[model samples]
Target chain A: MKRRAFLLSAGGAAAGMVLLPQLARAEAGRIDWYTGSDQNILDFWTNIVQPKFEAANPGITLNLVDAGDNAGLQAIGDRAVAAMASSADPQADIFESFDPRLPKGAIEAGLYVNIKEAGLSNYSKINPLAFDGDYSVPYRGSQVLLAYDTTKLDPANAPKTFADLIAWIKANPGQFIYNRPDKGGSGGNFVRRAIYEVNGNDTSKFTVDNYSAEAADAALKPAWDLLMDLAPSLFDGGAYTAGNTPSLQLLSQSAVTMIPAWSDQALQAISTGVLPETTGLVQLSDLGLPGGFSRSVILANGVNKDAALKLADFLLTEEIQSAVLTELGGFPGVAWDYVSPELRDKYKDVIPTTIPVFPGGDWEKAINDGWYRNVAPNVVRE
Target chain B: MIIWPILSAIGRTLWLPGADGVSRFSLETYVFFFSDQYSINNLMVTLWTTGVCALLLLPICLPIALYLRFAKGRLAAYVQGLAIFPMFVPSIILSYAIIRVLGPNGTVDLLFNSVGLPKIRSPYLTPWGPVIGLVWDNIPLTVLILLSGLGAVSDQSVEAARDVGARRWAVLWHIILPRITNSILVAISFTVLGIFSAFTLPYVLGPAAPEMMGPFMQRTFRDLNDPTNAITQAVISFAFCIVFGLFYVRSVAKNRKT
Candidate 1:
């Protein structure tokens, strides 16, 4: 009996040793990640993605650091951070910057790694025009849409066009509010959309391929004039202007009624009870598209290039994309037709089917010359 | 090595490229600042705000310092302690507290609302707030310096003035003013330098486009990452500060010689 007990104990010790390495692999080594996500994203990645990635790919741990926003992401470029994530286009890697003029810099600086070489260049999955020459990927796309508080103004009274919106502001003094273009992406997108509607000969004429100095100004003139005219009806009766977040704050506090907001921003606010549940989002009938789109890029020389590409690819997967669309307020980059039925039912109505017109490469140069000089001075700097 | 970088930045700031490798030195930045009219307006506002603070500080500080020197009571010690108390508080905490009082929705706004008036917008955000906060923080040192000067007044001089049939007003004017003129100059010099290098109070309180050297320097370094412009601005500010410092030192030396 004593010999049998000893043999059983020895057998158990050998079994423990056999299982230990496998268990350790399941918990993986840490892979540092940087993202310009709010606390919600921080929580989502930690609770959901981190554990799942760790479990599926043994010895792979994702340690995420919150960079908060674009400015914070830019700060990482100024630092020795492992990776960066932003909503701006590919000026830096694992981030976002919209300046189309910067693609050359990324290529020249070797700050970009072609995902095509990584066996993840599934370009056919995304909209043809949205695909870059192996530089950036559309992470989550949304357009600037008109949002209104139902309690203050009924749908019947809502403005349908930029012209209608301007007229309404005149009719009802001190009603419309938006942040300055420099302050927030959604706010800047809204202003730029106004420029597009007022300037472009047709929607297709607004593409990067078709951009010219004359087209920019001609499209921008009407919007510029309208904003200058409506400057009086804005906050402080045009005496002061709030930036994007503050403008949203004004909308939330019932200080203003009609404003432009991102689709996800509107949904995020409504879901969290930060905004009224009765809020409505609509695309302009005349413009067809919403406002703008965001892109994501990979750093060429990051600490974990392979892992970052894997994560980027995983994020683009139909399942993960669907989850992002349905669970998160973000719109999926994959075409609506390719979306799963579960995701389709959940987010089809909430996300706009219409693609927004983004400013081609000339957007930055035009803004620097036109709006900064002409528009900024008229409004109070606040 | 540091000097080379600073000089390079200054050279780049001053010289603009043309067709060839050679460039022309032009004060385009300074010209731009002046052309906007903000530079003069901001300077005037900064001075006026600092002036008001100095005026208010003068009477409150003088009496407390004098009492600390002449009086023998516990109250004198307490007064001296209280006069320099602002120096002990962290500058950020001090600035934040002022914001609470002067902000649009601050306590002062409540007072305005009670009278059916609009909320008071802060002068700080306009360029005045920082000057006011800076002077409040600076008054302690000013008082301490003045008090030390007053203490150095000899007992013999007072007796001599009394024996020579000098009236209180006459003695204060002729003897006290001349004797402490150097201290007064020192305080003024310190105040000028203090306001010149100031970043935080103005930063928290000033408007979007602050005209002072502080905000300009900050923007160049942080947002622009154009260290050349930042170094150039610093060098210019330093030049002006050095002139004032030299004048102050000369005045103090001249007074001692007399």
Candidate 2:
């Protein structure tokens, strides 16, 4: 009886070894795209990008999974980082929206593919925004700009410089407000732009790696003085909005003449009649406000690495970029010169010649915290 | 589970790495918190909000709780439901709803404007914003707690007070108030702690500067990416909540002992 049981166990173990590889092979042909986008963008992928890409490249199934929220995407990113460290199967081929930094050394460890070096057809067209590194390829860009109601304020009279913007706020008391810097990016960039304006408009002076207490004092104090001087003219006499959307709501309600808001959100709001037809958006020509981009990254170790590359390349194609604009009301990753003439013409007025970029890490934290500490509530450094 | 997270958080606050490799326990976080003017402002705002919310919650909730506890029939049921309505709604939705109903050019403004009145100043982004929203939010739970405490009061106790020719106010003051002391303590303790720990309501409705500790900790942790200071801010908030929590622990223990 013992000999028979041992033989049976050995047979079962042999079968398990044979079935595991078969199960692994069955998943080999499929590529999974993980995203942290909301339902609408996920719908764009499920209903639009999936079918189109699948039809273009037959036999390779594209599995687009909505990873819920940003933290969800970050979880997958951490998992990929772990897998890369351990040289294990990542189980994910493409991360549609992902964090570029994780597990302390994901980017330096090269856990993600460098799409530009990957030699995709649309490699040159991708926006040059390696927020961490070339760990992710950007597919859409959004700039923070001044959103003003044309009925209340003339489009031609929009603030063109940081000085002009600050003057306008004081000149028109209780007619302008941005969100708290810590609350929203529109206000954050607005604060960042102001910091640049005061410190000789030289953004080159600040870097993610080189922030020091001395540098913060020299660069930030002037910005605080400027903001503190301009505080009384804010909405409700030194009131700021809660967030980007609330700033827009203030504009729509005609409570404020102008507000800082994302280009995509303002355009969508105006198109949807949430903001009136008279609302206009303009970027600062003098050292333009910093912007952000939604990007995709590929797992370095995946069975379907080649298929994932194809999808990443496909996402950057002008066709998908236009779809991103039309369907999601987002700025295309491809430059205006690369897009169709009609698409270019429609969005030409709002496009920045070059999107001003700011390094995050320590500098961003200091500016945000400083805005809270020194700018808004009237705290001053001795 | 609860103790582990709390202990871990408390440990994170105490972790101070020296210039060398060795780790040591220090009050560096506490010192930074106390010395930093912004952090002190946040602590003051948190304390202010707690005090105002606790004080205001009683006046608003006590009358309704009294009505719900003493009154009868369909009106009492409707009043009870109406009192605790904010509990069912999520705080995010409540903040948005509060904005629409009470914000500038909102329903109140529009209604007033239709009658040709001037637009009123909104409390939407002011310090009062959180206080108003918090009071609205806390009503349901405060009422529920007070009602449970009121339930323990016997009808015969009130009748005995009445037999001694005690008026309504006298009976409520001498008989009802004394019996439900533990309940009021519990309610205030719970509300104060909850108010101190509240995030969504304050973030949505409160001022940008001098924000409560919840937003302060979040901005420090997330926006500032200063986990040490964020954890420090949290430790400060936890300390505040613990002060409020003691009242509850004491109340529960005293009742248990009895």
Candidate 3:
């Protein structure tokens, strides 16, 4: 009798261990969210947002999976493409789309659901520019700006135009640094702005869907000339740092006084003590820098389509947008008037009058290739 | 299962439809990769770094492995422990530690300044940086392999050589080195493979241009969005690796035959 009782108890315990999780899962449906943001954003979603969201909407759990950033974005896109190719459900219900062109491609491919039909309450309040057709909802935005150390530079003397910036770089040799164009978007933004300036501030020439090699060569000649001219004045005489973080590191260490950086990342770095508090940002008046919105897309064939739409709506709420601004230093997805007054006041000086989106795929590739081939060799010291 | 995916990748590389939506087998991708001088430069840089890494590591690891094999003391134990400790540390963390120690205003600069020496710029932005990091990160594995070979060496053979009036250097050159030829080949094979395919070290330490094959391929695939060219680059890297791998196989087979 004792042996039978022990065996029965052991079997019962094992059965409970296996079945309990399934029961809990059934009670609390899971929604997988894939993000390509940094650790702080991940923690905010897991530690703060997940618990509250779960509490308010019982029987639903938020599964946050950090995909990665930059390269991580590509990985998520590749997985989505593979799933779509096989006629299978994507791994995640909601995915953070970092590249603007990716969402456009996915939408065209019919891989994303039309969120406008989901009847999200906050969708109407979002900036219309943030919407890509009816498929994606913008989560955050960041602009590229010229960031400099106040200790090494005078704010009054900050360059207000592209010409002034180039002159400053020429005058202050080894005091400016920008990452390689292919490495990060910040350096690419600087190059694009120069291209815009060289075309007599005409933005329409390079924004087309089809790449014209002849037009590109004609427009990019002056920009390449400017870069080659500034080459001798760059940090280490001509060699650029590898990425955005390295350029910022050079700024913090006073090796270089100014660099083009994403406004949000630069501010976040300052607040987190990665950069000194004396750092300041300025938007050039004559030429606009490139910036874009980060959006969340719902997979058309995701397991939890309704839940993903609900979560995306929650991300656009005023309270959540406020947290995005304060906690992550990201611009709100809503209009400036919709954000809190204090947030506007805090970022007023650094904000540009216009934030242009990156050019379409064909033009972008042409510019990147052209810069590497025609300009990089002439500019790089080694 | 693994073969399926490998075959699928190869098929994609050979015959996958491109942006134009045309499916055909062609060497167009390979031609594109080689057409650019920059791409050719990247290939050369990758080979050069791999060669430099192996050349530097052989002298450094062999002496340490020999010492660890012959020495008997707490000092030898400590040396052994120190040599193996880096293997446990992640490559990312090790790269950062190296940057801090060797970067401008870092410990190395501070030491130089304290001695009234001129401040030296950090080498982290140059090719030397990745070469140094790769050599350091790979030393432990190389030493471990050499030590294993040293263990297989016969003490009696060395004693016999000494009894026959052979010098110490002669014994080492003829007996010890010959016995460990296969092990050295294995170590060289691993070193070449690791350095050729290294990403984080070169990405963080090396210059923006002339990137090693690993990071260059990643950029080409993802950033450039040219999967065809990326796969071709991978195929090239794989071909180089197979050459070394074949030598390794032959060495092992010969040792078995002997």
Candidate 4:
């Protein structure tokens, strides 16, 4: 597959020279893009957004590469592809905002052209939380949520807090399960929520500016102890864990009563009829849903700066955002009010009004602290 | 291409897990490697699998090699080809076949339970699954070596030993075995290194917790951004390769030294 792409790239580059003069006049040129979308989302991009963007720009090509799963994109980081279509900051003209973890130092080092200075069309419409007059803007905000089977769990008897959830699990053994947080993003987010509830949500101490090493450990102690106590009643005696896919599989099988689900998964389930349409959504009272502002970034060093900028402007447009958020499962980076009514209706109730941002200056510390690492495994042992 | 990558991987592996230095001057990775139980546990699993695989392969290969070596004509040629056939199938296919044959609901399990015998727990979840696969993989090479070496032993010498009033067991053990000693050493040394660096069999077939060093390397490089640890694992894996590589080289070179 890689070899085929290379051959096509070579062929396209040759064709590009012959088309360059014609492209400048009446203008049909290709704009290469890289995105971490699946086939369904890719179809939406190709069949829907690409045609619209190309029709508007006329004679412009939009070459997109699906960057694959989260881990694959993370492994390459933003720098490795900064020169390719996948690069956030290609060496030539384009810049994109797909990576939220764009290192502040790398951007400050002038690695990416600040989109704020680039004068994109309708920059004002972007949410301030996502577009901070900086190197990138957020395209979506996803959260981890708790869901229950409508048939087995009564809405009136639903657990409201971490303590309530645990007590319910104890009362009904083998009735609840969540994917392992270390293996799945939703599980990790759920674990973080548990830590916050136990620590009274004072995770600010773990930030670089105020990180007291002892305080971090102390905060996680109770959460760890609780997890150790709850391990046995977990699904498969806490031995078998599923990622989001398997967690959802278990839910669909009715093998589990409760599980931690990504907001998008729950929304997808409800939309597709895999989950009951009447399912209720709630945050733990003590710990609000763990949320993070998803940021997309442009590479400081990219190959085609002009084409990349054009692609970025195109993606940031309402047309693409509406089509993407509606078809793919997630909230858009634009404000809630700005979304099309059709898209809003599909997700408004499902998407949380508020999301927790990983407090600045190093979230890794907060995530890796003893509370999460030392105590999380006890979930299977009970 | 695979050989170059494996060799380059060996150089890359020399650097320990925690060492982040650009220049060559640190043993911090070694210290970190030894401090962790995960590393030690995986290494022990590799050794145990190697031992079990060697034990299972030796007896089966020896007699078959002996039959092919001394047996005359068409039968000998057919036996030689049939004996070497196991090496033709890739190790992964062999393992999958074993899983189907020995899995919980597989033929072996059904057979045992039908006879009122205790249900045989599968080795798939244990190091033994990989051990079995590796043993099956090495059988052909071991068989060929034993067969050819037995063929080279003079028929006249065996007949003379038997005629001198020596018992059948005594004549066979004393005269026949000594002639094939080099071939046995060569097979053992070569098979040891091959199994030591094996990754796929264990990765596809082994249990989760007590994973071999190979799977642990995959998780470190791709899942965890801890390249230092990945490099450390690659290094230890090469250390196994080198130790076994040197032994094989020495055994081969012993012929020149003689």
- On lDDT, the leading prediction is 2
Q: Tens-digit lDDT track for model 2 on A1-382?
A: 9999999999999999999854653177699778887787788898889998999999989877778988887887787778777877778888877666754677688777877678888878865542446677788878888889888888778888888888889899989888988778898888888888887888788887889989998899998898888888888888787899888888887878989888888888988999998888888787678886778888778779999999988988988888887777778887667778897787665777657677787787788878777877873311
Overall lDDT per candidate, in order of appearance: 0.63, 0.83, 0.81, 0.65
Evaluate model 1: give its TM-score: 0.63
Model 3 chain A lowest lDDT segment of ten: A21-30
Per-residue accuracy of model 2 over B1-258 as CA lDDT, tens digit each: 877878888887787777896778999888988998878988998899989999999988888988888899999989988987888999999998888888877898999999999988898888889999999999998999999999999999899889989999998899999988999999999999889989998999998878989888887787767899888888778877888888899999999999
Instruction: Give the per-residue lDDT digits (tens) of candidate 1, residues A185-221.
Output: 5666767766656665255556666667786676776
Q: What number of backbone clashes does candidate 4 have, counting pairs of residues 3 or more apart or in separate chains?
A: 42
lDDT of 1 by residue, B1-258 (tens): 866865776677788666787798878766654565544454555455555655666666666666676678788778778778889987777766776676545668768878999966555344567766877788788888888788778778977998999997787788777777777777777777777777777765554343467755665565446565566667667666777688789988887797
- Pairs in clash, predicted candidate 3: none
**Candidate 1 residue-wise lDDT at A128:** 51
> What is candidate 2's CA lDDT for residue A159?
87
RMSD of candidate 4 to the truth, in angstroms, is 8.7
Q: After superposition, how far is residue A143 of candidate 3 from its true place, in Å?
A: 1.1
lDDT of 4: 0.65
Cα error of candidate 1 at position A315, Å: 2.7
Better of 3 and 4 by TM-score: 3
List ranges where model 1 is wrong by over 4 Å: A1-48, A63-137, A141-160, A168-180, A183-187, A200-225, A237-310, A313-372, A378-382, B1-10, B24-107, B110-118, B121-258
All models, RMSD in angstroms: 11.3, 5.3, 6.4, 8.7
